[model samples]
Target: MTAGPDRPLVVLVHGAWHRPSTWDAARSALAALGYETRVVALPSAGRDPAPTASMYDDAAVIRKELDQVDGPAVVVAHSYAGIPTSEGLTGATNVAHLIYLAAYLLDDGESMYSRHGMDVPADTTGLFPLMGSPGEALYHDVPRDVAARAVEDLVDQSLLSFTGTVTRAAWHDIPSTYVVCDDDRTIPPALQETMAAHATATRRWPGGHSPFLADPQRFAALVDDIIRSR
Candidate 1:
């Protein structure tokens, strides 16, 4: 689906261990193309410090954003944010499309962690740290400084965020575009390809998990193309 008469607002949903600031680079590029940007502050990502924060909580916040926004929107969900966005955009009239940027696209009744075969019970919940060699695992292909800043900005995520199952699959109805980051060390490109089977279209990037950070302008251009496509 192509962009409608109204220039779609881009609601960026960041994944685990990140804040809305993760979209700064991509937002600037989208702004240059005259696209408005809205970043969702997911409650489950440890933003609110609320005790009940889970994927469901995050979806509630996102659905509220979709309800409050002025016009058609395109939600760009990265990594774990995909789960909430999928459920959050359910029945949301303002959303024109969903752009899953290396994000999990779960089917109804699927939890992001369970989809990956993690042996977590559905009701399990807690805080999980982003432990690993940050550079090699997440940003090997990204610039050093950007990777550094990302690590500094990272935060612990709610365990339930992954264990929580989506009740509705928004991508099943909303037009979607998936991008597989070939060099990604976190989420395998092969897994991304498997997820893309449900997308309206798919693209590839020879970058790591966070291409928007590696090359924001280029990533934005790709998103702009998706916005303009049929």
Candidate 2:
């Protein structure tokens, strides 16, 4: 599959408690496929101060990276990053597509918390309050040993980040794809289906929330195909 110059650049944006390193496997695979892959680490998830971090802060990080890219890019936003990606891509000539990986997809002026109503299962609540520094939180889904290993790679995310609203709706202007993880324990599969309803295309994988780590090859292939198609 030959990719065109006008073809979308692949930018992977990770959600809260995750650093850009989360996409390392997928990045290497996509790079080998002849596509440029850039991972934007949001300030909210950085070692720096997260005092005023909000959804727009994350959006700004994405916008800054998008400006560095030469052409339209395919932004693959995972989890919380989707909220900002939805707002950041507005009027961005360089954004060719928006891909959500079991992530939040909010409409204009919508916040991530808006989608977390009664639809979410009660068990999902226990996953929060993850261990980390005062400002940063890590995931509690994996086993203790695995979680400990993974926690070292996590960044801090503020609660205010989730409450921030996305004033701009990038989805209305950009083509989108959603990859639903059937085995997702964080975000329910049913919720993922509802979120993907507005996407241009939908693909499913038999992995958990962190499919890029659980099934890197399949995840990379799907992203590569999306870039090639564009």
Highest TM-score scorer? 1
Q: How do the residues 1-230 of candidate 2 rate in per-residue lDDT, one tens digit apiece?
A: 12246445788999777888878878887777677778898877765536567678889889898888775678899988899988888989877888899889887766766667523233321122444341222333334555565667765666667676778778887889888878777778998999889788888877677767655666788887776675
Which pairs, if any, clash in model 2?
136-156
For model 1, the local distance difference test gives 0.84
**Candidate 2 runs further than 4 Å off:** 1-7, 118-128, 131-148
In model 1, the worst 10-residue window by lDDT is 44-53
Clashes of 2: 1
TM per candidate comes to: 0.93, 0.83
Off by over 4 Å in 1: 1-6, 121-123
RMSD, each candidate, Å?
2.6, 5.6
Clashes of each: 0, 1
